[model samples]
Target: MGDAVGRRPAFLLSVVVIAVFGLLSAVANNYGTLLAIRVVVGMGIGGLTIPFDTMAEYLPQTQRGTALLSLSYFWTFGILLVVLSAYVAQQNFRLLLVLCAIPCILSTLVAAWFVPESPRWLLAKGRSAQALDTLRRAAHVNGHPDAVSLFPLGMKLKAEEPEVKSFAVICSPQWGKLFFFLSIVWAGFGLLYYATIMLVTDIFAQDPAERGEADGEGVDIDYEAITMSVVSEFVGLTVVMFTIDRFGRVASQVFTYFSGGICVLLLCLFASADSTSRNLLVVLAFGSRLFMSTGSCVTWTHTAEVLTTEIRTTGHSFVNSMARVTGVISPFIVQGGLPYRTIGVILFIASILTTIASFCLPETRGIALGTAMSQDSTTAKERTGTPNSQEMSQSPATVSDKEVV
Candidate 1:
């Protein structure tokens, strides 16, 4: 929707929908009603890709990874906030939902007043005048008066306006390999990362008799483990902020996932031992979590980088939707009645899959975000030694102004 219309409109719509659904959830009288409303809220959340792609288009390419990874800070903070809110609003869950809408409302107001549509989108649509206006405003705000030089007027662009709505574009030979590979990586990582979190909680759970005693003694959530989990995620993000550009996206992913897999496997071995120590398990869980979080950061940042601007939002939406679906299934896979040792094997396999997928993907550390799909395909083929597809003949050699936006 953002690709067809504009980023600002889609973003505002998402925010409004989320706020409405959130409020509706607060008033929901039944569990079914709440569950249904939450699904709607998830749809609203799908609009997140619009702003993420827009930010990528607007930011300097060199700093894009750093800026995008920094966005994770807000997500981790939100998780911590939710945990604290659960503690505070134990029996007042409805009130908690209502309070959550406040930030959404405020975000809508701020974005409406401040956020601008993507200039790249405007230019692709042939609204050069509007694109120029947006660029000028950005220049003035950034205090870069010479930013106009970056976009020279009347320069002919060879980019073909992509068919953003057609799923066929992604399925075609030119893009299919990359798209399929990324889909696996996204699903596998989401499954492993979420399953591990759930598995750790289950691992630390007390037996039925112990649970009854703990309840009588007022012991509830595992504060130590939860705190470590949240803190390790932040630590991983911080590490990525410094290492992503230095190591490149592909190398970072390969190393993180491979290392994380080993850590999880070791943790499983320790768990399988006759003498299970809580401290040893916690240490191993923390190590696995740190690398998993690091790998997750790389996955998101690199996905945005490698995709072309025309289909960037659509691609992000698809991959994110896949991740969410896998996340929903992860808990069942890990905590399901399967053998306990099987958990480590599952995650270890997922990590190896991610590592292989990372190798298949091209490096995009210093690549220009504004490059077109056609240009990127050529570069990717050269880097990977893959054959160029004849599908290039299908795209127009010269796109006239009247033929595109």
Candidate 2:
């Protein structure tokens, strides 16, 4: 994600195309057409998620999660804002797609102007002097002073020459364990997020005969539910940012999945309830998104944080891409069922996968960005028993989601 090659115009153009896919989705005439559009949207999103995670890895550890969390907020805001914009444009249906393209075009312009080159990339290429300058620039972006301590100081480097690690290099035995953890975590992330959003529309669009009228009772229901769902994601990201370091990565992620599971399961009960219960279901669905994303952001940050610099971007790109495979199928799996309980069951499956994966992980609350953990090395043990201290001083503080936001 932080690689210099990723900053080239070609990759940026690909991201723009992804936005175009989402922009055209409303005009899709059939299920097949819409499904194809969504796949395009997912691919674009997959592209975006990687670069952003790489950005976090390139920044200082103290600011890494917060920086990434803020990006998620902007991503949330974009989703929420776009839905609202699309609804307005729907008044003149043909123009809505054009309006959708406006934001993407504008973002492309802005990114070209200000998205800084990755400092970590420069370091990997043996451009140490330039990398140091890039670090100062990043500190300025993060609202820190450009003084001596602006960039982290204790990081040790072993690479003597610039060598680009191939994607296949990612699967070597040393990096494979982290790679597996990221894959499972990202799959669980993709399923929970996409299924819930996809089901929002399906649940509201009951049989045509049973659909609520736009009057007091309305079939504008899908719009209503999806809008709230987007808003809830912003709120979710906010909660994760404040408490992410406090709760520790493992605790935050586990809470998101286990608690999100309980919240989504409430939908099953609500599925059987009266109209008032149905109304409550909307809020519950929104809350479920909140928690799921909360964990997703943390999980992504952890994945980027724990891997050694040699394989960091490879690990990130791999997980983000694999996550899309689950995302492409999740919508159909949930929507194909008659009862919405089917969706609840699928989410429960994702939650369980995430929960089990969380246990296989270690807490990375204060770990520095770009440093790798050695779980099997006894002499390198850090803060194993000190749960209450700021961080164990025995060893120097060591290094170590999500919508693309």
Q: Whose TM-score is greatest here?
A: 1
TM-score for all models, in order of appearance: 0.84, 0.80
Residue-level lDDT of model 2, residues 1-405, one tens digit each, is 334364434347556876677578768888899788877766666556456655664655566667777777766777777677767875565477666667777877776677765555555677655655665665576577643364344434323234345777667786666667767888888888777766665565555346444344323446787778778888888878887766667667777888888787776557645564556868887888888878777777777667655556556767877778888778677767546666687688779888777656655556545443543211213223223333322111112200110
- For candidate 2, the per-residue lDDT at 377 reads 17
lDDT tens readout by residue for model 1, 1-405 = 887888889889998899889888999999999999999998998888788788777776557889989988877777677666656775588988977777777878888898898877776687766776676677777787675564455544343354287656778887788889889888878887888777766666545555556435333556567667768789889998997876777778888888889888888878777688878888888888888878887888888878876788778878888778989898787767766678788889989998888777776665566343335543544334333332222111112211322
Question: After aligning candidate 2 to the native by TM-score, how far in Å is the CA of 259 from where it should be?
Answer: 0.9
For each candidate, what is the lDDT? 0.74, 0.65
- Which RMSD values do the candidates have, in order? 5.8, 6.2
Clashing pairs in 1: 125-405, 126-405
Where is model 1 more than 4 Å wrong at Cα? Answer: 99-101, 145-163, 205-208, 211-219, 268-274, 370-405
Name the weakest run of 10 consecutive residues (lDDT summed) in model 2: 396-405
User: Could you tell me how far off, in angstroms, the CA of residue 87 lies in candidate 1 after the best superposition?
Assistant: 2.4
After superposition, the stretches of candidate 2 with alpha carbons farther than 4 Å from their true spots are: 1-11, 19-42, 91-94, 136-164, 206-208, 211-219, 272-276, 375-405
